[model samples]
Target: MPSPEETVKLVQQSMAVYVKPREQAEHVRRVIAYHLQSTVEGSRPGGPLCLIDASANISEPYQGIRGATQEFFKASAANSKALEEFETVRKAHTQLNQPAGPVIKPNRYEILDDKLHLINQQEKSARLGTLERHIDILSEKPATNPDFLSLKPIFKDLRPLVKVPREIVDSLAMDENADRRDLASLVEKLDKVLLKSKLLLTREEQYLQTLKSQISLDPRSVTPSAKARALDTTRNELINWIESELSKASTNADDSDAGHDSDSSHGPSTSGEKPGEEDEVAKKTRQTIMTKLGTVKESYQLYVAARKSLVAALKEPVSMSARPVAEPPVRQPQESPATTEGSSGTASYLLLPYLSKLSELTAAQKAVIAYKSHFNVALAKQLKEACQIIDHLVPESQLLPQFPWPASERAKHLNPGSLDHLTAAVSDQPDLSSQIKPWVFASDSARIATMETVAESIEDGQVGIESINKTLTEIASLFGEVNGDSASISQGDPWADLALDLGLLGPKPRP
Candidate 1:
């Protein structure tokens, strides 16, 4: 087989022969044609080896070209195989490194072809990519009617050497039609997956809201407000109970009156006075008075029950609204541990409890921005809503004073000149009574249970995004690298050498 250098020289010579005078064109055509035909037929059944040897002797230039073309194909196949192997390795490396580092691997094969040798170690894929462009130039080569048949053999022999792979050819044939169908199918499947996950996430969120409402209504950790509500409910139920009893009493009274009337009609005066009989109107009035008295008693019972519930809740620590003790009893205290500790240390202890909450809020803010920028608009919106809920529940404004006390007033309160001075300084500061308790979410066990449900749903959404992101990355990588187009060719044919060198004529491969 001819080396790559010889291939280049042979191609130059062939082109040179093509552009020569008319007489020379025919001679060159016959030489190249006969040489290619003999080479191709050498493997045929009953083909004579002697004739093949003789054909070589008839034309040295044609013989050189045939050898070069054949060698070119052999080298190309070897290079192509090497590239494929390296590509697999590269992909493995890419997977290992993932989201970072180098992508392409180093040269795995040494190319000896002159035209391709310019390909450097760092640019192996790039240099090898030129083969398609060169093939394109070859396909565009021209052929006139006079020498078309003579040149046909040479063209036919070289065509298969650089032919596009069967798969690529098939792809090109169906790209416009089949590609759309395949993409549509893939998109539909992915969309279904996305929609299903999205719905699941939405359901989880709704369930989380339900959990919050349940937590809000939980009887365990009852606050003062909740106790009041319970009292009111009890009062209402008692009133209903009283009304029911009165209705029963009224019904009994009506039955008794009808009985007395029937008795009077049956026996007018068995005795001077009756034992169980009375005037119907008087009896009805008496029944009405009793019913009214029963109603009043029921109302009194309801009021007593409600008042007792409130008083009992106030006495128990089980209630969340139980007032805190400002100072514990100091029996035989020679500076209690809390009083002895450094004020700064105590302050830091107080601050530490809130740090985690601050961190969570900060992280959620970043998540909101990241999801929005990453094209997950719905998730971003959801996160934003969550943030709003958090802010509303634990308003930052309520945690600190709108305006702080002046230094003079602070000093006066810290070291009072007199009781009147101390009182004045305290009065100058913001009203402590006006500040309501800060809302706490996930602070109590019941609230935390509800918030955990929300957290679980958020995690599910995150998992879904990660899964979809992986698929999207794979789709993106499919189009990451592509072969470049070949340089433009001249408009018309002129010199035979130039035409043949460009691969414009003879059987050249299409891109």
Candidate 2:
């Protein structure tokens, strides 16, 4: 029910409510990691690996927060999915309005009634002749004509519903029957004979109603203006539903966050390490990491906002000229101005509105494209920076469990005798994260090969802007951008599928 502008504002506000707290939680995790890294830097050989305990304590709760945030974003992404569905339905409605040639089928009930009347008339005529011949003293021949041919075709059209065998109906028509009881028996069963026919007619009516509703046209009655209004109402309701869901999700997030905060306050510190033990450098590192995390989070929020704004803008109705223009009549060599003046004047008036709307829509389209391109470039850069920081700080060798990578070359350095000591020792290695990536590749060689083939097959500029952004995010999340390069090798989701959905490529045509 809300206006488009109001709905967009509500969505933005709802997203922000969920996003802000999540950003804070992410910042806290980064701070803990930064401080632990500083502690690891200063620790002596053979001494306790105290930083490991700090990392473990912070990680458990942060994992929960991260999961909640991911769910919130996933729910928010549903709005985009809803919009896509609306667009598909809208397109189908547009197709329904397009000029289809004259239909062969009329109201099924009308056709059936007419066929029944013709058959009944023949039966009545034959009966009258039989009765008349009963008292005939003045006839040369008591002619009894039973029209079996016409009745047979009508019965055939009714199909399995008209269960009377062709032979039985033919016998009733061709053979003269004077007994009223015999003729009455066939007349009485006609309703039973057309039971399936009635059911089929009902089904046809229901189907027609479905098509009418989908295209926002009334089956009972419809005019051009009424159809347009119906379409507008449908569009508004879809947008309203999207906004309502977003609002509900935001409210639920707030309630969940409130409970989480209450529990955190009452709960004892779950960290392995005691508090007040971190050095000055470790404390400073925590503060610095928090600041950087905030910056990254803000950049991400900005990116999300821009994308939503584009979606909102696209939802507003584009004034399309739906009616077809008739081709102008060919002019005689010396046609008078007055003769053509009325039609030409009318066309000019119609075209002015259409051309104006087209120009406006075109300009809006260009603006949207420019904005999206710029935003994507910025977002890609931000993702690259964030990934670099995460990769540099979090040691992947320490992250993975030992059993899963027993024979992995990356795990060879990890000793069973002093697992904790080995973990801490490997965390210091500069190339440890880089080494882990090779292990991933080795483990998922077949999947990697498939993904690579898909990526290679995809031609450039084939993917939709939205899908491309999503793909980039997935890539960054799984395998952070390395060496300032935005390109990444994905372990899931073929790049070719994304291109195919965008209509840039399709299945190869058969010969």
> How far does residue 349 in candidate 2 sit from its true spot (Å)?
2.1
**Would you list the clashing residue pairs of candidate 2?**
none
List candidate 2 stretches off by more than 4 Å. 1-338, 396-511
Q: Model 1, 1-511: lDDT tens per residue?
A: 5566875685566445324687875785466556656777654435432223211222222343547355434434544554555567567645754656566765546434543666555487666678878877777776434566586677775645676798888766844544345788798567645644664566568879999987765667778767765554454444445546856876996787678667766555675675444566556676787788666655555554555455455655675575755442324222322332344344445555676789998899668645544554355446556656655654455323333334664555446576655553533422222222122211343466668998999999999999998777666545332224423333453432233334554543243
**Span of 10 residues, lowest total lDDT, candidate 2:** 51-60
Backbone clash tally (model 2): 0
Each candidate's clash count: 10, 0
Tens-place lDDT digits, model 2, residues 58-150: 222234434434443344455445455556756875676556887576899999999999999999999999888865744444343345445
Q: Quote the lDDT for 457 in model 2.
A: 62
**lDDT: worst 10-residue window of model 1:** 433-442
Question: TM-score for every candidate vs. truth?
Answer: 0.15, 0.16
lDDT of 2 at 313: 43
